[model samples]
Target: MDARAEHDSDTRAVSRAVSELARRTRFPIAFGGLAQGGAIHVSSIVGARTRSLDGLVVQETRGLGGRAFAEKRPRLALDYRTSRSITHDYDGQVLSEGIATLFAVPVLVSGRSRGVLYCGSWGQAGVGDVVARPAFAVAEELATELRVGEEVRRRLATMPPPATSDAMAPAMQEELRESFAELRSIASTVTDTAVRERLTKLEQRLAALSRPAGPAAEFDVRLSPRELDVLACAALGATNAEIAAELNLREGTVKSYLQSAMGKLEASTRHAAVAKARRAGILP
Candidate 1:
């Protein structure tokens, strides 16, 4: 698939998951991922627009999203109307839209907090713990899907684009450039460093794809999803212990994933694997 198409597909998947969850629950649901710049970027919204928060980004340690990312766990405010512990940078936005009850859960993959999922109510001021817990699980699934999507995109990058002689129209080419720029901007804001860096590279590749015809760029070594998962955790600067915790695997299993990733990348150490993966288009 084309880079643009891949991004659209990922977003669509997120939307579908969130929509399904929203339909089954009373509160509105929104799913988002961490951006490179350590900011939480909303990816999908599936509920009442009681607020114009479908695609909003919340900075680290600022609001509920920020707090969730900071604590690397679910953060909740029983009543948004009277939460004194959390910052209210986006409160006006919520208040204007009548979003009173709110719960935020950090999405984690490979021991790293990726982004946040939010479930909220417009009429009530308190969010039940029961709702918050299940919301976290759903967010975890969304995060996994994102990791899988990233892996697929990496694989697609390895499969060389079809041979063609014709160039795109100038207008279409410019549009691609604009789209790539926006994507890069989004990539830059992800809270996870590894995801952000990989996204940056992906953005660069897409930009290159938009350039006038040239020799196809060579791809580096590829990795399986499991290996990619391990490398992603390592790239996040997590130890095997941390990776194990994140993936719910034994530390030995984490080591095995790292070893396999290293072997694929022909790396001699964890650092080398991460470095080579980045160079090989495996780590982001």
Candidate 2:
């Protein structure tokens, strides 16, 4: 994808993250935007009661969201109107929305702040682990999406166009496999339905790109998501323990999934199972 497409994807990701934040934390309002020119330009909002948050631009260290961005961590103002720790730069917009309490979490990627997500309520609400954990998960999911996009774009830039022959270059095939595995890993961890669906589509595209230039192999087997995840990691030569750790499953569970996948593919070993999956277009 080009720079414009990448920007649009990033924006969509931020929008989804904000929506998920609102749903997960049960906040009355949620909004956020990606960093541009060293500031968070609010672009997406959910559950807002008015137009007060529209077009809101938050500068680093200037407000609640800004402080989160500057510190690369979450910040909260229990009483927005009388908060002494943060500047009231966006109070006109925030207060106008009747948000008495506010929380901000920065989308940190690669140790740098990429943007900020804000959740607010009409009344003061204590942000305990229940609320904070999901907020952090949403931010981390968005960060993972951003990081994956960057890696894919960088690899594509260095890669040559596909050849006319049926076979792909060994190095190009390896890169595609790596990207496919990474996308699967991310998809397994993502909770938002829309984001997960988008990742699934990307995974399909990568698999299609890596297929040989001929009629696709006709196969009737369907592997479950966890089975696919385990297979993808195995394709990268990861052992059962490594796949277990990466997928956050027990080693026995990973082995079970692998064995099930192997049976579905009628393969006697994990290596054979991976090869069969690739041939069946079940993997990249």
Candidate 3:
């Protein structure tokens, strides 16, 4: 999708998240923004006067959302109108909406803050952990989706355009094979299962695209999911113990996966297995 469409879709998801958070947290208003440049530009809001928050911008470290964005953590203010915990740069707009208590949850992806989610009450209702917990859950879900969306856009940008004629040029065909291999490797690092599955299917479709019109290669290199997971890390030069720690598996299990992958690739050593897999378009 183009940038505007992508942002529109993300805004819809953000709307649903804020609405649910407002319902669960008993907050009268919920609003938030994705990080852009040095500020968080509020993009979605619920239960608020649109003029008060619509398109509001919070500079880094200048407001509750700013503090949370800079610190990469949650920031809270009970009685925000009179609180000194955060800068009062946005107080006029916030007070216009009669908001008192506010919570800002930073949406983190791969340990970096990408956005903020705000839950607020018009009264000094004191939103405690009871509300913050579920609000953070929604933030986590948003972070996951944003990360996948980033990956999809980044990868697809480099993909070859549709063939004008019936045939793909030889150079483009080889590039597609390499990209398919990279996609499989990328899938191994994705924490979201559905995103990983989508990447796997993309890799398969690319593999099919690279084939001749007649029957393709009879030998389809089949590797188990675990095997792919283990080798993808090993290809990055991760040690067995490191791989085990990263994958949350026992050291023995890591070794077992390595051995299985080597056997399936018909390679006698771990390095050989990695090289063989790369040649077979099983690794980037």
| lDDT: worst 10-residue window of model 3 | 210-219
* Per-residue lDDT of model 2, residues 59-104, tens digit only: 9888999999999889999999999999999889999999999999
Off by over 4 Å in 1: 1-3, 28-36, 49-51, 125-129, 155-284
Q: Candidate 1: worst 10 consecutive residues by lDDT?
A: 180-189
lDDT score for residue 28 of model 1:
57
Q: Rank the candidates by TM-score, best first.
A: 2, 3, 1
Instruction: Write one digit per residue (lDDT tens) for candidate 3, span 1-284.
Output: 79898888677767766777787787878988787898888888888864778779899888888999889999989889778888999987888888888899998987998888999887787666788888887887777667656765666676676575667766566566545544555455655454456567766666566444564423356889778778867876779998787777899998999999998888898899977776665654
Candidate 1 accuracy as TM-score: 0.51
Whichever of 1 and 3 has more TM-score, that candidate is 3
Candidate 2, residue 43: CA error in Å?
0.5
Give the CA lDDT, 0 to 100, for residue 45 in model 3: 89
TM-score of 3: 0.64
- Model 1 Cα lDDT, one tens digit per residue, 107-179: 7766777677677777674556557555755676667557655654554454443435576555544444344
Cα displacement (Å) at residue 171, model 3: 9.5
Those runs of model 3 whose alpha carbons end farther than 4 Å from true positions after fitting are 5-13, 23-26, 49-51, 156-246, 254-284
TM-scores, one per candidate: 0.51, 0.86, 0.64
Clashes of each: 11, 0, 0
